[model samples]
Target: MAATSSLFSLSFAPSRRRSIPLSRSANPSSAPSDLSSKPQLIELEFLGPKAGGDGSSPVDRVTAISGEKLLRNIMLENKIELYAAYGKVMNCGGRGSCGTCIVEIIDGKELLNERTNTELRYLKKKPESWRLACQTIVGNKENSGKVVVQRMPQWKK
Candidate 1:
């Protein structure tokens, strides 16, 4: 007798059967028509060589980090010293309104969260690419959204 192929795969849970629209963004925060004028959804990939010590800093090598991971790492790496403050201060760990984790995306502008009044206040007057990291977390699904991050402007250095 020949083995039969089941119509449904029982290996994965039924609840996990959710599908993501490839050409469109399921996240309202990352929508394209957002007031910010920045592309709200895209897949960002690591562009260049690995980041390491050859007297090279994080910015020296081209490393791609998801919007969420980037925010967490920045807060952790800087010991929470970098971000600015928001109303009453925040402790919920980046639910996207504190405006503390504002950052600029140097490349791959498509992947990001919508801009808000809080974020606008924090980002200094500059060219495009500015965004709030805490608000821009990307999912881990294949070819999920992403945004490229770079160090703060040179003057802030």
Candidate 2:
């Protein structure tokens, strides 16, 4: 019983605490001013359906920071419609598993990352301009440019 009590006391003993200092920049002016360190603005132009069947506007232009973010996230953040009615209910939530988030790159394809293996498998028969927004990254964190995107129509899918 004494040994058990000692073991219980040892287990309940207070643990040692270590203080960690918060890291902060010594001089804000000394920070690197290189272009790579700055956030690049990526202008996005979203073209809705031509016939306006989905009740969305024809064109929407927005800006995002170039930081290797997914195109789907940028579109969603900017309130741009990226999915159709059916796709809204049956999407993979940016996992690249479902190809419902397809967008046509009207221009500035160079600003996007290369197609992933999932995109290649899913869009093998599709046009080269068609990209899965879930699998598409807008910029490489250093490039600043304008990208024109057209939302894929429901009938096109």
In the order shown, the candidates' Cα RMSDs to the true structure are: 13.4, 5.7
**Model 2 RMSD vs true structure:** 5.7
List clash counts for every candidate, in order. Answer: 0, 0
lDDT of 2 by residue, 1-157 (tens): 9999998877666432224443334446544554236688889998885646676648899888886689999889878889888899999999998899999999999999999999999999988999999998888888999999988744543
Colliding pairs, model 1: none
For candidate 2, give the lDDT.
0.84
lDDT for 21 in candidate 1 is 35
List TM-scores for all candidates, in order: 0.38, 0.75
What TM value does model 1 have?
0.38
Model 2: weakest 10-residue lDDT segment is 15-24
Runs in model 1 lying further than 4 Å from the true structure: 1-56, 59-70, 73-92, 95-98, 124-126, 139-146, 154-157
Model 1, 35-144: lDDT tens digits are 55542233433222233556443432222344335454544454433343342255346665455455566665644455556566766575557666665544322234
